[model samples]
Target: MDNVEVPDYFICPISLQIMKDPVTAATGITYDRESIEHWLLMRHNTICPVTKQPLPRDSGLTPNHNLLRLIQSWRRSTGNSPGAAAQMDKRKTQETSLNQSHIDKLIRGIGNPDSQLKSLQKLEALAIENEPRRKQLVEFGVHNAALHFIMQCHRGKNTNASGLPEALHVLYLIRNSSNGLKLSQMEDVIGEIIEAFSWVLGCDGETLNKTHAIFAMKMVVRKAKSAQLRMLKPEFFQKLVDYVKQRGNKQGINAALQVMLDSSPWGRNRIMLVEAGAPFELIELELKSPEKKTTELILGILFHLCSCADGRAQFLSHAAGVAMVSRRILKVSPAADDRAMLILSLISKFSGTNGVLLEMLRVGAAAKLCLVIQSNRESHLKDKAREILRTHSNAWKASPECLNLPTLTSDDVC
Candidate 1:
């Protein structure tokens, strides 16, 4: 093996080692998949390493099957026999078993105060390391054990404990990995998980830990049944909105917005979030978020918030409320169009005042409604848009422009 000189073509450009899983980029350059993912996803590079061509963050990597087969053939021809390969594979399994044994010892020590933190640290490393180990951890019931550890932390109010941070981080990684089994309310641990998240969000901690806390709750809420979601208290909603207002990190904000959406199915959660100043934060986020998906999320949450009286009040209270909703109507995707219209419909039907009508007209809300009716839109959306326009036609007619605009009838709206 030492006498064999590896071909330069078999080496990864970035890693300078034999490629394990070679993947070709959009720029037609080959690289090791793990190395390229680290460069593009973790390091946040927008260009190919070798070609320097623009590579989208979400672009797929094509497996270099030909190169992989060639590498395998070369290895087999170079005195790498079946028996040797089998022995190497057996050794690898033994090594993995030894590693898992050490991890299991640490897991058992988690109950001991002196070594608990160190154990949790090792578990976190294993959980976060790579895909195979994560799957192994799941198979070993680490997720369940971590939940118990988290519950202990929650009950003890040891939010600042070193072990709890690692436990939360591990739980988050497990929740995200596709290989991990789904958690449910039937397990009777949902409440404990929520409490753990609340502690992390409300208490002071490292930014990374807090970020993981927000994402963990997001995953928890996304997976929880409607009954479990309804069981969440107002404080839960309040903390989520407060985290959004705090705007700790970009990923955390995204997770908070998603959690808000997930929890919005329960009517009380909507009001609680409104009370927590979610509408204001959402409006601010909408104004700031230029991404289509993020803007749609903000608008979707805003639509739910606007359904309730308190939510509508909070939404309208924002100076750019009507204007921002109006601005997104035709500019973004059709889904955005739907959400924006629903929000405007709520305000126009229940919260519309003369001043509000004039504000709508001045902010081009009236014009957007006209565009919705005139454009190729769904029948219901057109009806709502026309209803909005006709309901305020008399007041809007005060503006000469509104007077000259085609007068749409109730029948037309219907």
Candidate 2:
């Protein structure tokens, strides 16, 4: 069997193994059932591995019975022994059996100053290998150990500690696993973890470390109670804002935006973020025309920030803020359109000075609102766009740009 040449097409693109249960994706690529399921479901990936086409999480997998039969026939013709299959099963059983004790040992090693780095590397590798391993790590409270290690490094001023990044990566994997890490019951522990993340974000570690740090921080912020979120230090927000302004890695930027959005529901946190100059940085970030999801996140946060007078002042302070929000209408996803419209609605209602309203016309924002009214967006969103146009139509309708738009009506101005 080892020397036999297997058909290249018989191998799974993900696991690179003989196709045991071959299934075809919508993209017309065949992969092993387990491998593709893990890729789509466990890893939460949306792109087909072979075709790089959009593969939704709920996309059906059609079983390739003919290919399965061919592979089985090929295996039988190659005289693949039953003993080899038994050995493979035994190895898998051994791996499953060793996980608990192995994780226990690693957790103990994380406490030891000398073996911390090596232990973290092993744990990180295990966590990355598969979802089950990550769930096991979370079950064994490895996230706690990882957090403890990070806090220790923070206290010891060990910014350069090799284990710090590995520990952060491990924590992120566990937190992001299908069976997410359970929230720590102790408020103090949660606070300490938040502090540890703050230090990691501000530290001069590798960019990868800060990236993982922000990802983990996002999860923490999401799980944190309102009181806990409100308790966040000013420096925490400053660090996140600085990361945004500096434009860290793409994932890091999104995570930071999510963190801000999650915390923005609390008025105090909103004020803190606005005070940190988040509005300016977010507008600057948006002006660069980020990806769809990133744009949604940025617009979502801006929508929240715009709720307050100070936030609105900060958002309106940017010359392109209103224009950017207007441009995203009907151009990005439905979510982006929703948030952008909400932002425009807020500015027009609360801060609609003649100058601001006229600027909205000058920047084509009024024209965009008219487009939204005619767009195939959700009825509620279309209604929202119509309302914005009606509320400010007197100012917008007089403009030649808006006058030419067929959707603009006398009733649009209230």
Candidate 3:
């Protein structure tokens, strides 16, 4: 069967295998019945894989009997029968279950120091192979085991442990299967997980290990409760800030930024981030013109941090901070614009010292606010921008940056 030159059209695009029961989707692309059904029903993907057009779950799939007959005839010509193919499929399923059993054995051995690294390597390989196996691993509670292993490594100061990276990678691959409610219920476990992430971030381990650590941490933090978030140590925020400063990997930097953003809703975490010099690092990162999503995450964290006096001061202390926020207005994304506006609003309302207001004018922030008022951004954002301009009109109204904009008038200000 492996030596047979099967027709290309007889292959399922989703599974990249020979189609046994070909079915034609509404988009006119034929796929194996099992593969297309799993894609549309199980995976819930609404788009046709081949045509990139809408293929609604409820859409009808007509049986392609002609293609199926041709496929069966071709198989018969190759000395294979439909019964043989069924037997092969049964054998494959048995093999998959056997692999699962092997994975279960490895997961159980993850706690044994002697077999830990080898077990983690095998589990990581299985989790990387396909999504179904990853789901199976999650169902087997591999995430719990991974978290426990990470805590163990942190406790032993095993920064150089060969298993740490594999463990972290396995957790990251199966992160989407995390049960948020279950995690939120386990406050103590959440705390230890956060601590483990902090240890990994602070350790002088390989860059790949740190990257996976942050990625896994980002997932955990996203699912953590507010109570869990409030209990986070200052060192956690400091390590994350340091990770962001390192800028080791693009995805890692983005994950670190997301973790800070997710944890910044609490006032204590906000202060901790500011104390860790987050504002300085964020401004520097933004100045480098990061990707749009990274910029949005950075601004989102800045907006939250700037809600405090120290955070605002820390933000203003960076020469490029205010200017960078202003530059991002109406430039990056609507999310970025929203956060940039909120950050500016915090500065103008809470930390509006004379020097800061003048600097706002100097960096064309006031003009950006005027532009926001006139831009086609959301009404709420425009209103916030107008209010900022109006509140600081006395300082900005006379400046050429503000005066040159026809939208800025005495009536626009109190």
Candidate 4:
């Protein structure tokens, strides 16, 4: 890197990395597309990184075609080809050599300070270009190797620090790319992986590194055996909740949400999440425009959290909690609707104060329940919705609006 005399204009202000797909923002400054998008869209920043100018939240990024061509020409002139170009193309795929001996040698070489950097660069290049390479790396125990590599950094071993980031990147890419990868194979190190991720979350690192840590944590937590999931500590859950509150990146937030969902199946995990203030944060997240799966997982966590009184109270503490759940019933997906119903059921059955019931009515929670019953979708969910309405019918029935609306079914035993 010291040998390279790249032009100052070529670096992204946020990541300080060479601009691959350069884009010009409304602020008249250029940035790498991925880096700027992470800043604006993922981190929800409203200011341009370089100019410090206020950017409209929805401002569009214009591609810097001229800068891109110049960068490409420079790379070609520098003979950095093939390697730099391959690394830039995230979607590029390649066939792995599948040489077990070669893989073993790379893993062993990672212990050497000087060689570790070169090995990690090579591995990261291989891991990013294709699924086959990632699969092969996992097959050759790169998962454990990469985890150990990060652990070495934590342990103050491998004093040469050049490749630790790349090693982590490769680890995240391997787990994310390969479907057959399993955490069961590394059960002994699950705690170490969690510890490493907690360290990453707390440390001031590159945004991508923190993002990778959250993704890796999600994968490890999701794939751990049932017993292992139940054994996770509150500190781990607290770290995840902190990540959610930090709102560092969208991918990281979604990963944290997934980790909570995967871990929430355990009763204690739900309490931990609730105690971590996950419900309020999740409700706030829902108010933002999240991807479909993100919304579903958030709702799923809320459903589990609502199972307990503390969770229900925390969820209801959010001003938009009831309204947000009502709005998502028919708008998102079937899975979301199912979970949202359970959340409402828990609140109505246990915490239905007069104010809560009135708030539900005002927020269209009552209307949503009626729609659920009329639609006859997901019979179990419909049944629960009916129970909520009927159980509170005396309160609802007193309302002239409720009286003017549809009549109660025979199931309104209350």
TM-score of each: 0.76, 0.78, 0.76, 0.73
lDDT of each: 0.77, 0.80, 0.80, 0.77
lDDT by residue (41-105, candidate 3, tens digit) is: 42222557566677765789999999989988887787874555565555445434535577678
Stretches of model 1 off by over 4 angstroms after superposition: 1-103, 184-186, 400-414
RMSD of 2: 9.4
Q: For residue 349, give model 2's deviation from the true position in Å.
A: 0.9
Largest lDDT belongs to which candidate? Answer: 2
Could you list the CA RMSD of all candidates, in the order they appear?
8.6, 9.4, 10.6, 9.7
Clashing pairs in 1: none
Clashing pairs in 4: none
Better of 3 and 4 by TM-score: 3
List runs of model 4 lying over 4 Å from the truth: 1-95, 156-161, 176-178, 182-185, 400-414
What tens digits encode model 1's per-residue C-alpha lDDT throughout 55-133? 8766789999999999888887777655545554454454344256766787788888899876776676555445566
Pairs of residues at least 3 apart in sequence or in different chains that clash in candidate 3: none
Model 2, which residues run further than 4 Å from truth? 1-76, 79-90, 185-187, 398-407
**Which digits, one per residue and each the tens of the lDDT, describe model 4 over residues 295-370?**
9999999998999999999988899999999989978899999988988988998999988988888788888888
* lDDT tens per residue, model 2, 1-414: 544565778867666567899999989999999988776643322667556577866779999999999988888787876654554445455554445777889899988879987798777666655666677778788887887788788788788886786788787778777656776654567767888888888888577778788888888777787778888888999999998888767878998999888888888888999999999999999888479989999999999999999999999899998888898888889899889989999999999998898888888887787776666778888788778787777666676665556666765544
